[model samples]
Target chain A: MSERAQEGRTAEGPTAGEGRTAGGGHGTGGGPGRVLVAVYGVFALAAGARAAVQIARQFDEAPLAYTLSAFAAAVYLLLAVALGRGMRRLALVACGIELAGVLIVGTLSLVDPEAFPKATVWSGFGSGYVFIPLVLPVLGLYWLSRRR
Target chain B: MIGPLATGLIVFALVIALASLLTTALNKSMGTVLLVALGVLEIGLLVQAGFVVAALAAGEGPTDTATLIGYTAGTVVIPPVAAFWGVGERSRWGPAVIAVAGFAIPGMVGRMLQIWQGMG
Candidate 1:
């Protein structure tokens, strides 16, 4: 049955095949790259909406955490768009910043928990998110370098 | 909002995620079984959403109704989109996309449960 779906995709797979065949289109679209884009898109939407609500509802309760959430959300959005467009340089920069942000925020949250009265997406290396926030940048960096 | 139903959906999503992940690990594309499983999950999620909406209308659910509804709507949408995108790719990552969506559904549903309880 899966074979039927596989055949269906091949029957209409110009975009997928073109993603690989089209020169200089490594990052924008392809097999693994498409997965990455999808993951990033989900994260962007999740994080962005979370930050918006947190900030709008009670910014004073945890301004730092909410702001950082907003920042992380923006980064995820940029990374998703940059990767989808195959903007290698921008994607690289975004991945680097994300790595740095997670590390810094993770450490800070651990050392001075009071600073984050509420949890941001990066808090505790995204433990609330099953640590994907910590791991995604590492994967992104590896994927980007491999593409280059 | 519905206790056992929420747990059932979460477990169902988790199982689907694990199956999809297994396919990706084996370097196989998503199969018909997985697609059908996803469709079923989506339908279950919609049913869950309907229940949540009905509960909210009766003023028996979370105080953060907006967020709860957002999560419910988002959860219902992920599976079909992932399936559509997954079928487009012919590689292991095609299943990888489904795996991600499968994982996301449980996570989102869990959050919705938490919101319904006002645990956040």
Candidate 2:
């Protein structure tokens, strides 16, 4: 997808009335865009699976934390979709939400360790995942903004 | 949890990651050589997995079976996934993806070993 397409721009390029693409337009065979989609897909799978397992294994132990994990995973999936479909507005929203989630969760987990009896994907700023959770949002936002 | 073999793998992965990062920084894309290196790394991981399984069969396994298996399996998955994504771009980011995957392997492996040793 072209950079304009990534920003949810119409054929006229960044003009008004360009409805967000329902899905990413990235699977066009081969390119940097496809590679980005693939990486996002990997994160989607990892976060989704991890959250599912956490929720399944012990939802009662820490409902908030696990639910947050699920939420983060959902956001990641959405971000992947947005980027893939070249839905710039949706991608921007999702990436913004991701950044917010990481910051909020990161702060809360640090402030009150007891609240997070179990670690979520964003706990300790995603220390468990080697801080990629924290870093990914920044990259996503940068990628999106560059198109704008 | 921190065996020599596992450590060796982690270090090797880190080295590869550094190489990838440097290459990508230089605007170089992942090419045939890097792809072959990744393949070789995958083969090495499979061999390591086989060794671990054999050791377990001999009753010298790590403490946690399931987590150990999960880690072992995870290590094997990273390279191909990265390569699949990496090859398509043909840009510096292609190798960047490889770098990320390469770095992740050692950390995951180390964590798995820790779990196996009942440390985590």
lDDT of each: 0.83, 0.71
Give lDDT tens digits, candidate 2, residues A1-148: 3653333222122322222233322322123444455556666656666667667666798898888878887887787677767777887888888888888889999999999988888889989877888988887776665555
Q: List the residue pairs that clash in candidate 2.
A: A23-A85, A24-A84, A24-A85, A25-A84, A25-A85
Model 2 CAPRI rating = incorrect
- TM-score of each predicted structure versus truth: 0.87, 0.76
Model 1's DockQ?
0.29
- True contacts preserved, each candidate? 0.31, 0.14
Expressed as tens digits, the lDDT of each residue in A86-140 for candidate 1 is 8888999999999999999999999999999899989999998889999999999
Docking class of 1: acceptable
Runs in model 1 lying further than 4 Å from the true structure: A1-25
Model 2 misplaced stretches (Cα beyond 4 Å):
A1-49, A128-130, B52-64
